[model samples]
Target: MDEFNGTEINFHCMYIPFCDARDCDRELYDSPVDCPDCNRGMVALHFTILILMAIFITMGNLGIILVIKRNKIFHNSFNMFKCSLAFADLLVGVLVVPSGAYETASIMMRSFDPTALNRTDYLIGKDVAMIRPDSMCDRIYQEDIGGPGMFLSMISVLSVMASIFHLVLLSIDRFLAVWCPIKYNQRKALKDKCAISMIIFVWLVSITLSVVIPMSLGQRHFIHGLSPAMIFTLKTSNPSTGIFYATFGLGLPYLALLGLNTATGSIILIKHRNLVRRSSLSPSLNSGGRRKDEVKATITILVMIVVFTLSTLPAMVAVTFYNGTEHKKKGDATIRSIIYSTLILLLVSNSAWNFIIYSWRNDNFRKALKNLFTRKQQRQRAIIRWKQLKCSVLLLSEEKRRRKKLIKLTEASNSYSSEKM
Candidate 1:
């Protein structure tokens, strides 16, 4: 059976250079034909948008990293959350962006030559590509597909999970800092480090589930008969898959952050409000700027929550509802293009907007940024002044020497005249 299947698999793979099989039957399928309009304009659009996103995200996240690393003032508990969020976004760009680009390219490439895709072979000949879940033949042949699509999808999922998990930690940190001030002040650094470690653990666990388990042993699919001839496509589907992801990656963390942010942030706001009321009513009137700083911090934290939610929720919604739509095979390009553009914009924006949100909304962050830029400007001005001074000094010294030389020449000429006389 192995020898016969191996011969059959080679025949199927002959058309697809990238196809390989580990646990799939190869003899039952034929080579697929090209997909005329599968990826079409969408692939180009996806690539363009992805490339631009990669560039924009890289630059923006780097700015956030620099701001945190370079400035001590931006290293507070809440600001630390901002930095961690930025770092997570940066990791997404670093680890997942290229794979996203590749996935887009692969879909586009397969559209052009669907039958020639080696990834398509595992998809077509085996039980991998079909969307149906009940067939025992499909059920029994679960371990057949392995390729870049699966790998990239796994990493992308991992990045998303990390982003969500870190956001939760960030929200919790802000919550604690606001609602539990005494505790926050006492053990801020140790708590922050521990939170960071927990974030790392989140990523480690997420990667294990998202990437490692599925690749090691999961059912894969191959799309058949989408083109002029039989064509292969790769995918995976399980009833529990979406639920599992939603529960662990999306649903749980989202609720955790939202609940904590709302509860703790509100408590802080109310307490501070009462304090302000008392201060305003007091006879001494020496409360200074305490109320104002407190109010500003509250507003800043609120804005952070709002911005984070707005930037990320849309993509999550899209992901959640992705399996619901019954898109046509022919319209794959259009659908993917639209979805990809929107999703990438949202995801990338989450990373890109943190700096502006933090700087504009939080007084501490704003002041830190102002001081940084001011110092930079002052240094530049000092350099310019030094350069001007050096040039002026050189010019004046040269002029003095010229005057001395002329005087000596005049004396020499006088001496020569006297000798002649």
Candidate 2:
């Protein structure tokens, strides 16, 4: 299924990877042609990673969101970036996983029937209404999946960019807050940041390509390749713009994020060590709890950046090498196949690894997990307290009412006795 952008014109593509044994392997070849064993392994590996990505990214991000929402201590400007990064990845996992899985299925089905795409569409009720000569089951796969796959890639690119930018901002925020707390706390200075505006701008720029690029293609269902549906086409000497975007959007920003965080975090940690050493002389330094928190946050961001970089770097390098001018000359097909397979693994793993970093490195994250699980205990305690208060209030009200009633009765009886006398 797919939809256009809303009032702001956000476009979306939903796809599932459904390549069969031959095409999967053949994708890495000089031309999209034959290769059986490589294709099957590729397909199997993609599907397997898709399942793991769905589970890990989704659950991990959900945990982060839960922690951020629940823990007041964790709720700060810097944490907002982490929340956004996790959220974007979470969404990417949700959108991409099924599409990837479907793509794998589409590929597999392709071997049995050339018209496998149309046949898949028929099962999903996505037929073009114009009958095509495909097996009914595969119609949706043809019309919907491929084009949507490209669009999904575009969206994923945007999400990744947003996540990176957010991380960068987070690092900056921490740097300011730690190094210059007074300035950071000032209303005027803090207000100047306007993170919300930055967020909007980032998303707008990111979302712009999906909506506007189609204008070049002239609002077609999908392009067969890079051919724009409309009149305009961008000719570039660089052969692999799409691949470049995919790699750079994820890779370069992460590299920058990692560097910026490392430099800033090291400075903060050094300062913290100094503060700790001089803890005896300065009463102010005694409240070094904030420094500790800063260290923990820094470590978490640094670890996340490292893990994301290492996990995804190989694929970026592989794609760059594969798309290089010498690729055709240097390739044993076997080596090329190996590179593509490795790239796929990296790409799949990239979407899933952040959660693992949090679980392993972040004490706050672990505490948040504990809080999430033990929420029922907290609720039970609250309920018990409420019940006791309610009971005490009821008893006090009953005693007061009884006293009033007795007083009224006695007054009435005394008045009657006086009249009779």
Candidate 3:
């Protein structure tokens, strides 16, 4: 079946470029698409990896959500953004990833039969349906409208967008807090209520873009050379949807994150430098204390930004370039499946690493997580968590005191004027 002309083409042959003929002795490749990577042992290994990664991602983020909920220290407005991001990341781990991983693994498992490495019914679009005769991909393609499948499709894009938006929100919050602390505090826009409002806005926008109408009707165009397992996410036939998602959904927000985080980091560094200058001149000043906390937080954010970019951008770029049933037809299953699935593993790796990042960089998060594992030493852990978090609380309380003092002075002046009258 490995045929280009009426005659059968040998799998080991190289194409003679000028002669326009494929031979085993020639330099150019004709046999490379046979997928040396899709051997049973390799597919099984990667399959195991996907499953394990999914489990870790699900459990890790779930722990983060629980720790944030149980601990009072994490209830601060900025930490609430972290909570929202964790929840969105959790949804990706739970709803979007596991099933897709299973589908991908199934595809890989049967990709190259030991009996027939050369004979092929698949690797071409016309016989693509034979890749899975009993697959629900058929049902999905037929508009069978299974609720779970449809929901999964929606959530694949949905959770990622929400996660990205939440990260953007965190960056914006950090930028505001660092670049103009006075203005940031005066507006009270990122107070608990405002944080809740913004979180709700993120989910709403993600739903509208990824699920509500665009994916509501399930207008899917299957991509050739890529498996249905991989195609399930971002399933749309609309050029407009793809274009808009590429431009706005994936593009602008990531750009915004880069700009905001860069600016925020630069500001924090400047402030730290100034504090160091002042501390050197006046040894009595405690100007260096909060700078450590700010720097740590900034570093955590930068780490997350880097992880998000590295994990996600490759998948987006690959899927964008090699999209649709018409695209990548010349390529064999080996290149398509291996590279795409590997990129997906990288993408989901983002969900798994947040707990590690927080634990490494953040003491409050570590303390809260430790509290979940043991019941003893409650008071010590509480003190530790409170110490880590109370600086921001003290600053907020100090501002409230100033506002109250201003209001009292105004009231006294008005009362004195009334008495004089």
Question: Could you say which candidate leads in TM-score?
Answer: 3
Give the per-residue lDDT digits (tens) of candidate 3, residues 1-421. 3442222211111111111111111123222122332244544565567567768878888888888887776776678888778887787777666776554444333332233334433222232322212122222232223455566666666777887888899888888777766655565646778878988988898888877765444434312112232324553445776777777787888889989988988898787678678765754344345556666777788888788889888876765554323333334533455566667667767777788899998888888788788857577778888987898799999999999999999999999999999
Query: Pairing residues by index, what is the TM-score of model 3?
Result: 0.67
Per-candidate TM-score against the hidden true structure:
0.60, 0.62, 0.67
Candidates ranked, most accurate by TM-score first: 3, 2, 1
Clashing residue pairs in all predictions, respectively, total 9, 34, 0
lDDT of 1 at 31: 15
Task: Output the TM-score of candidate 1.
Answer: 0.60
**96-182 per-residue lDDT for model 1 (tens digits):** 565545533343232222332233222233212332121111221221233543454565556556666766766666566666556
lDDT at residue 22 of model 2 (Cα atoms): 21
Clashing pairs in 3: none
Instruction: Compare candidates 2 and 3 on TM-score and give the better one.
Output: 3
Q: What is the lDDT of residue 243 in candidate 2?
A: 54
Candidate 1 or 2, higher lDDT? Answer: 2
lDDT of each: 0.52, 0.54, 0.61
Model 3's lDDT to the true fold? 0.61
Ranking by lDDT: 3, 2, 1
